[model samples]
Target: MPLRGILDRWNNQSLARQFLIAGGLVSLAAMMLVGAYVTTLIEAAVTRNSAASTALYVDSIIAPLLPDMKTSQRLDDVTTRALDETFGQGALGGKVVSFRLWRKDGTVLYATPDKSMVGKRLDPGEDLLTAFSGQMVAQFGSAEPRDASERSRDDPLLEIYNPILQPWSGEVVAVSEFYEVADEFQQSLHQAQLRSWLAVFGVTLAFFLLLSAIVFRGSRIIDHQQQALTQRVTELSELLSQNKALHARAQRASLRATALNESYLRRLGADLHDGPAQLVAYAALRVDSQLLTDPRTPHQAREKEVSTIKARLDEAMDEIRSICSGLVLPQIETAELPDVLKRAVDAHRQRTGLKVALSMTNGSKSLPPSAKICIYRFVQEALNNGFRHGGGVDQSVRQTFDNGNVVIEVADRGPGFDPASVGPDGLGLAGLRERIESLGGTFNIFTSKSGTTVRMSLNVQEMEQA
Candidate 1:
């Protein structure tokens, strides 16, 4: 459970905190390895120096008493007294605690205060062998091998083994083993270890702090960029929402414009049929009644008068019919786009006797009724303009599909008028633009000195149904 808690805390930590923790752990491991190695080296050096100094002190006290510090020769009464005086109290001002001498064969030659072990043989271990090889060995503990003397002495001691040399030959012959009271030495070694550990900890902490600072700065930068990105996303969402609303409003306005244009066309058609047609019918009746009058004048004079009046009335009626034809449209509500366009061109050729080249491809049966009517009327008007303003020759109407939109183009080889010189009151082009635009379509006119072309494109899928 404790392990789980630690893992959970680590998981929930911020990136900078996690980074610092990981780096700190790695740094701690590195510091521990270096500190342990250095401490081991320091321990070895202190032990070597202490052993050498202890060996020197022991040798100085024992060298004069024994003529052969190496051999297993029995000690005399004078030498025995010297050994007791040196080690029973302490050697070198009470620094030494106990002492022993060994033969090369592992036999105990002498030990102060333990005279019973004088001739007992024991195994010479690795430390004893090292001393016999002319090296000193020391440790801060009781001596080993579980001997009776070691069992009786339990106090912490500096156990040292010093090699005794043959003075004349300079050869190691025996080893001297002894112990020293180590209360002060143990305390001093512990103090050194503590100082070394403190130094290592301080350095590790300083390095960890420096690394944490760098990680903290990077984390803050990441957080700031993330916040800015979030804000940008929010603003983009708002803009998209607003764009959708404006598009809806534009669709509503276009639908309103289309309805108004249709209303105007209906009103114009009604006015021509009701007002001008009635006036022409009444005038024709009056002229016929006058011709039927009896004996008003001589026959030829009356006939010429009636003929002149009849010709003028017929001319007026023809002009009114032409105006009415332009205002009213055929029943093209159920016709397809291609059929509607063909009907308009066919009617123009019948009325004006002008041949129009036609290029058409079949499709767009899905086009709405209003779109079909608009196409028909636009084509009819364009053909009329070609016959009146243009030469009425070499005209063409092309209908095709481009990118899901139906395109109709009418062209004429006529003297073209400048668009800039045309006034806003040019109802033909202006009404065409508004009609196409309302149905989510576009109208464009391209004119050169040689010819004039008007093109209309409509997307029936986007148009409002009527």
Candidate 2:
């Protein structure tokens, strides 16, 4: 479980980091293995070459001085002096630590620097037995040394077994073992091993660096592509949300348009019934009056009644004209936003004799025909309501731009009415809400004892597109 957890953490790291960790471990192992192998080979080759040269020089000096072990396992006094002079005064003088001649039965036949060791019998070790079998065995103290050999000193020592050959028969005779001081050989071997390790390390480091560079470059590319993909997804999500909102607005507008025709006809019928229809009916009743039908009625009285009927008919005609005037819209489709607002305010002031302050700033001049119509009606109706309910004190109409949308606000400093108390009738507030929302706009009303504010926000960009 711990190993699984460790692997999970490792996998979570970036590609560059992962490659650096794994490659570093592998490179370390490879450097150590290869370096150790190369160093071993160099040490072995240096030891063998140095020991062989030293053994040949010693054999030339000491070989002929030895008595043939085939005849006797002892050395003559003359032969002992010859060996001692050779080691003491010759080329192997300081370097030769000790020397010995061994018979086949592990008897020390001759010895130098310690003549008491002569005639002492010792056990024949593996190296001595091999030397008697006609092969030289050489070892260096710095690398591997035998425990009981005379060459096992604190300083580096090279020990060798050089076998003596009989003159006549080529039979195994005896073994000569000697130890040499080997400071130069040890220094050369160390230098060779150091160079081999450095070469291996250099090669391994270069290879790891090249791999790391490539991995890091590819990781950067992958990270960049992932960021770009994430950004693209965010953009697409915003576009989808906008499309859904647009589709919802379209559906509302379609339903509102379908109901508008029926509403208009019903309002027209109600107006005619309340104003012209009543007056026309009253005039017809006056026409069938008993005074006009009776022949005995006086001419003067009849003339007075006839004049009264004419006045009533004229009043009825005026009522019909007023209704027609309220139903028809003025020409405002091609007018700019400022002109549209001015017309509405002026028409209300002319009709009701009320002062309305109109202010516009940062308002879009270009708009759709439907937006212009809606704006005009909104201003006209809002002003009428303010005058009726709030006494129209400080009446003001404002048109402004906010974040690409046009805001229209009608405010008055009067005792405001409760919004909850407003009833659904006469298409006053309800029609205003429908008109604004059909275009995907928003309407809000804020009321208090100090003042009332009715605001509508329309998207100028959407209207321009329409």
Candidate 3:
């Protein structure tokens, strides 16, 4: 299989199985190391203890019989005979497979059952050196040893190095090395090693089972939680689908209503311009014609009255035309967001004849036609309020896209009005807020003694979704 396929298969396995496989391999390696170390120590201890017992027995029998070598280098006939009697047919007969007594000068003083090998100048091995230094060394010649110096020999024997000290001065005068038939010792050593390995295996099994039980319990808990989380996620997905549908419906309704409201405003503006504004203009023209085209000479006070009436009619006509212009909006539905905002600022500048700072940065995102209309109306109302109340001082219009949301701000550095006094219904602010919120956007106004700011933030992503 490919590497990715293997990884996927491994990942698909249950958590418990994965841990069991991994932890079992680790445990097996640990058991092998611990068991080997512990059994090796057991075999060494048994070999030493058995060798010490045999060495102690041999030392007891022979050390008393041997002549003190502090005075004589060679053993006499009687002393040599006593040593022969002990190893040949006495207490150590069959158990002693081979025995040798060495002098400090490396000459064999005695050999078991055969005295011809006596007086042979054999060099001392490392074991003999240790015995000469007043220490006993022991080894099992048929078993694998933990240390190299305690290495096994060919025959099945327990090798012993017994140091013989002089009775009076406690000085080691001679060393005795013996090899005993180790059938019984080997049996005991093998039994001990087996028992030790069984104990290690038992401990390893108990530890592995205990850890596996704990992990299995934890894995079950995690699996249960995963199932519950999956179910909760499914429920949330359904609810989100329903919310999206409701939001789309609300967006459609808001669009339709806004279109109808704009249509009504346009008809109202056209009516005032054609009916009330035209009639007012005609009345002003008739009064001016009457004042100038009259044949009769008029009195001074009456002439002034006719001229004043015509001037008032002209003023009324101008005010009517202004109201009509305010009601009808420009054709901004097809324009982009930046162009729409520019048109609003330009119109405000021309009407008020005041400087309005307009700032645009990153207004390149595509917006819905309804959103563009909403933004235009928002800027229009906020600027008009700022001008009427703030004396049009230091007016600034800023537009930007902030984290996928379009933020437009209109602010003025003038004496601000108290928001609480205006309430929610005053200055058409309530209508503007309704209009913005209906399209899933936000409107906020901040007013203080230093200045006033009207900010509108719209989420372009949500608008696009709608």
What total of clashing residue pairs does each candidate reach? 0, 0, 0
Residue 238 C-alpha lDDT in model 3: 90
What is the Cα-based lDDT of residue 72 in candidate 2? 79
Cα lDDT, model 1, residue 125: 91
lDDT of each: 0.78, 0.84, 0.82
lDDT of 3 by residue, 15-34 (tens): 99998998899989998999
Against the true structure, candidate 1 has what lDDT? 0.78
Among these predicted structures, which one has the highest TM-score?
2
Global lDDT for candidate 2?
Answer: 0.84
Q: Summarize candidate 1's per-residue lDDT along 190-243 as a digit string, tens digits.
A: 778788888888898888888788889989998898889999999999998977
Task: Give lDDT for model 3.
Answer: 0.82
RMSD (Cα, Å) for all candidates, in order, is 15.1, 5.9, 17.5
In model 3, where do residues sit more than 4 Å from their true spots?
Answer: 1-14, 142-155, 250-466
